[model samples]
Target: MLTRPISEGNLLTEHNVHQNYRPDVDGLRAIAILGVLGYHAFPGEVPGGFLGVDVFFVISGYLISTIIFRSLEQKKFSFAEFYAHRIRRIFPALILVLIVSLLIARNVMLPNEFAVFGRHAAAGAGFVENFVLWRESSYFDVATTLKPLMHLWSLAIEEQFYLVFPIISWLAWRTRLKWPLLVAAIGLISFLVYVFSSPISAFFSPLSRAWELMLGAACACLAPKILAPKSAGRSFYGSSFSILGLFLIGLSFFGSLTTSLFARPVLINVMATLGTALLILSGPAASLNRLLLSTRPFVFVGLISYPLYLWHWPIFSFWTIIEGKSIDLTSRVLAVSLSLALAWLTFQFVEYPIRTNKRAKFRLATGLAGFMALAVALGLTAGHWGRHYDANIQKIIDAWDFAGYPEPPGAFHDPKYNFVSWRANTENEILLIGDSHAEQYINAIVASLNSSADRPSPQLMFYSVMSRFGIPQDLLNKIANDQAITRVVVSYFWSIKYGSPKIDYEIRCCGTGLFQTVGTKGGSSPSENEMRSLDAELEQLLTALRRDGREVDVILDNPFGSDLAPRSLVRRNILSGIQINAGVALSRAEAIERTEPYRSRVREIATRVGARVIDPMDSLCNDTGCPAITSDGFPVLKDYDHLSLSTLIHHVGYLNFLR
Candidate 1:
């Protein structure tokens, strides 16, 4: 998230970045970046943590707009010069982090994951990550946490604003229009677009987001008239505005989630933007500006904030992927600490040395241009390479069928099926319903009962509420209408429907269970109220099914946390080779423990609903732990969780549950 440019206030120094440097602005920069860091590392701890990006946008607008205004007034404005400063400010640290994250990705990422990283990395280099992500993301697809370069979306918006807006401002200022009023008008329109436009446009459209930055630009354009030296330095209005500014910025932290769903054009986002503007106009002479906001520690963070932002996300994302769970508090802290240290190193060794040297401008331009070329090549090559690799991964996945039953098309047709295919089985005695994880075992179930009198046919829900609620009424009616259907096997990954607090919300859809009546965002643990609602709904559903004389069985969630799977017990052979977090084998108790709270809770719900609990570990685990690898040594879990069909059929007792 660094060579994310630092405070716009500091940019006035590019004619010299250090000589005219304002420490108070650096403090503000520190606040914005820290808020972001806190939000990423611990989202529930800071639900509105994303408002920090809005804060940065305002600071950038103020600083860049100020530079342009002064140059234009003196009749010496130059687009070449403005963009040169941007390159110096943004390119060096950005390239450094891109290289660093790619190195890590090559070492650990699955072929598919690495390919996605490459694609987004290329987008980041081109300053269009926002568009790529916008195009890629859907309401139910491409979740934010899954994207390693996700935070770069804001940077794309910021950089695009820099590229396009200054020219418009220059033209408008050259006209009879008052510069401040024109900018404010544009800001008002943009804010309206953000509020009224579709959410996709609001999230990714530069037009919608530009207003936050323009608010800063307006303050810069009007500052000289409204906050003259004598008036700013000694006026009581300066101190009062500065104090109000600080309060509003702080308020977004506590009261943002309720201020509409998207993290833009909302009351809290506007508050943070206006807050930054007020502080900038308050003049450095304002006491609050100099005393608390300009403290050395804050300024220090600001100094390295760009690189810190760049490094933190990839580190946190990769770590979460490897751990296969929500980052515990300790791991989150460690990731942040490592990010700070690496950022400091990158800033000192890469950004500072190159950006500060006037004589190095030619060298800086050449280096960045070359680096840009390399980043693009690296991205394309990685993607091409991973594409080949994924072909093999898919082939392996294709082979995950049972001994006798052939795997159906991974994707299917039919409106009733929705996304995946759902054929009424020759028997149609058992209806398998849920998301993708629920589909993983269908082949195994089919193989076990291929010739049995009662066969389990899959009715894929594919996605949770985002598609349809648990087992759509249509599918239920189909089952109810089938006289041959004597049993209903309700198996789903409950965690997918009801997100787990154990996983970060950015990575997950939501923590609320599928049965929950009240919906909430993806940051905190599921509320007791939601859980109660879920249980009540399940009870009612089960009651209805029993009244129809059909036996019901609910499969609990599978134990997750195997991103570091394929674990080998013998880290060091007799020859003493060192091994890290390699292939892992977990016990039965630990497997059950891993699925806890939700696992136990699901078990309770099943008991209450008179449904039998079909726990997979009964077959996979005995008195000992569940071995991650089979005796033949193939890893049991394919990715983080879902067992391959062969593993489930051969080892996990797919036949027992059918009866």
Candidate 2:
């Protein structure tokens, strides 16, 4: 599951002293790999199938610990030999995948995307992929399917564990410490960290994830004592335990569990880990183990599971990148089929020869190491010089880097309240408050002020936080007491703030970034309660500002869709080698239908509170559709929704209200 094959002598062996292969364990590997494939390809049907990774952790931990414990007992454990074997097993398929991915990325990806991919590739080769992904694990980060090397995080964690756990095993054996006790102690500490840490940390941190692997290691330590020629009732107990384990694993895979690991309950992972341990403990003679797992088909899949895991995600991801959206069901199935074929070929031709060639083991290890180093260098070079091979594509990608508008020279930073203010020599100031949507208007506001030098500009104070639902009491008091602040503007991604879909809260620095956990496509209609809450909040805030005779304006959210993204405008068919220029537009009718509920509610609240309403749709949309790219070839929206920097400079007249 970590993309390392379980070779016959080391992992598949079950006896304490002998090297007898266990085909049932290979069958278990087959299950884990298939679940992962299902989760990646058809997530809706197998919502919890991602839990297969946790199962893999247990399998890897158990097998690796078995090898270490057996080797230590035999007094033949050499770290050099152990690491060399690991290199031989891990590098063959991984090297091929990384090189192929880089080549494909160079030809197809945009400059910024290629830069990101290059960084991921370097991290993958250096075994630091987990750390890189952990840093970038944010709600605002790009979608998972768009990241080709995202799956490498698990492999990196496994490698890190292999590096540390062996030394711990040796130290414990050297000091005469009980292996089970040591594993339990370390696993307990890791479980505590996993439970208490931030979601992103819990998901990606090797420290937090160690307990799952240790669970497998614990099984290895205890199995011999627990199963040493036990009574006749042992068979009955094994069958029951194995059935229970299968049930738990099945529930995890098919149940209506949340797909977002960050938001999913910890019980899901616990169930999967416990289930995997149960199945492994059930042994080869158990009814399900012998009848189901040891079958020829399952064993074959398990044999190639390492390569299958390595090959599947990139194939799916590259298809998504080329299509500029989620691939169709047919495409996903085809991708899986292709991944299976490639995985088999890689296993037979690449992995088997390198792993089994006894005479050339040293040469193969050294050569693999050198190739890995080369991969690191090429990845770094690609990141540094993100020059696309195609000139026309490179020119189109150059337009993606839209620079931000600079803050005014006389801006004041309020550390206590965490807001920025642009002070002008004027009698009154305009306060802009909300989330990032409010922040996006700063560029247009500055441009408007600069264009109107004939008149005095109002002092500008911007509070870019989630103030739409609940304004900070301190900031509200500041606005109330400060008479110089004569006008207020409110803006937010209204649908996200009041959308009916289940909210998955994510910590975004000082405030939470609200994300709808419905699906990747779109969201459901706003609930009545959400609409009413928004109305009440807006009315309360507007009335408070109006009580002091200050003007208030509510700017509606901009029209947005995946089709309106710049990347979606340019697409490539990798197979056909054809480039297609897809038009970037969202239907005007659809935009209105999406926003009308919140728009009408905000309008009613503002009218009642004596505040004005500003609609961006008037400037952004036409009779036909809302276009993302301007007529002159400039991108209007930076991503999906937010106005681009170019839009701020070129279309400042839309914010005449600010002037």
Residues 1-659, model 1: lDDT tens digits? 33433343333344312214567788888889888998988777677677888889988888877777777776767776677778888999998888877776665555555787898899888889999977865443443554668788888998998898778877877785677777878898998999998877888889899898888888777777776666574478888888988888877765655555435447777787888888888877777788877777787898888888888988887676555445789999999999999988989788876776667665677779788789978987895664233333343434322212345644354453344333444344455555556677666665555435464443322322333234566755665665655666666666655556553233222222111102333456678887777767666656666555678778776655433133222131212222333345676766766566778777887787788888777766656677665665455665445675557667767445464
What lDDT score goes with residue 503 in model 2?
22
What 10-residue stretch in candidate 2 is worst by lDDT?
507-516
Query: What is the number of backbone collisions in each predicted candidate, taken in the order shown?
Result: 15, 0
The alpha-carbon lDDT assigned to residue 457 of candidate 1 equals 45
Task: Choose the strongest candidate by lDDT.
Answer: 2
**lDDT, candidates in the order shown:** 0.67, 0.77
Candidate 2 backbone collisions, by pair? none
